[model samples]
Target: MDGGVLEDEVNRARLVHAAGLVAPDDAQLAGALSASDDAIAEAGRQRRILAATLGNAVNVLNPSMIVLGGFLGSLRDVDRDAFDDEVRARALAASAENLELASAALGADRLLIGAADAAMQRLLADPLG
Candidate 1:
C-alpha cells in the first residue's frame, strides 16, 4: 500500500495513543479493534485516510495490485467492502478500474520482520552497502 500506513492519517492513531486517548499499544491498529470504541473509531478514520492517500499513489503509479501486511491488513480485514469502496471512490476512474488489493500471506503480526525486509531492500538495491 506504499505510504498508506506511514501517512498522517494512519499516524493520527499513534498520536492519540500518545495523548492517552486509546489503551496502550493501540497505535498498532490490531489489538484494540474490539477493546475500545475509541480505538475502533480511530481505525475507521485511519482506513478512510489511507484510502484517500493511497488513491494518490494509484494515479501516479498505476499499480495493478497493493499488498497489505501487518496492521494494515488488520484495517482492511475489519471491513473489506467499505475499504474497497472508499479506495475506488477516491482513485481516478481509469487508475482504479483495474486495481486490486491482496493480503500478505504471512498475516498481520509480522511487522518487525516485514520492516527488516524493507530495510534490506534498500541495501540490496544499493549493493555497496
Candidate 2:
C-alpha cells in the first residue's frame, strides 16, 4: 500500500540500533554484518524480514532472478544461505524452485554506467540527438 510499515521496518533508525553504529548509514548495516554477537543476531533478524519480503514478491510474480544492487548486494552477501532458506520457507514451492538471487555485476556504479551506455547508444543511433 503506502509503504509506511515497510519503511518503518527498513530504515536507518532501526539499523542504527541493530548495528550500534554512530554514523547511521552504511555503518549501520556494516556493523550489523560484523562478526560480533550483536551483529550476528541483528543481521539474522534483518535478513529474515528481507527474505520474507522477497518471498512474497516471488509468490506474486514468479520471477526467475532477482538482482540486487548497492547496499542490497552487501546485505545479501552477509548471509546468503540463511536468506535463501528464509525465502524458501516463505515462498511457494513452484515459485521458489527456479529463483535466483544475484548482485549487480557493475557494483555500485551500475546505474551511472547504464545511463552512459544508453546515451552512447542513442548518440550512435542519431548523431544529432
Which runs in model 2 stand beyond 4 Å of their true positions?
1-4, 12-32, 35-38
TM-score of each: 0.65, 0.74
Residue-wise C-alpha lDDT for candidate 1, range 1-129, written one tens digit per residue: 445445655764453573345544423445556457766777777787778777888888999999877567677777878898788888899999999986677763467777999999999999886
Taken over the whole model, the C-alpha lDDT of each candidate is 0.72, 0.72
The number of the candidate with the highest TM-score is 2
The residue-level lDDT of candidate 1 at 28 comes to 43
Q: Which ten residues in a row have the lowest lDDT in candidate 1?
A: 18-27
Candidate 2 global TM-score? 0.74
lDDT of 2: 0.72
Instruction: Look at candidate 2 and tell me the lDDT of residue 127.
Output: 98
Candidate 2, residues 1-129, lDDT tens digits: the string is 245565555544555565666664443465466756776666566666778788999999999999866556666778677767778789999999989988667864677899999999999999986
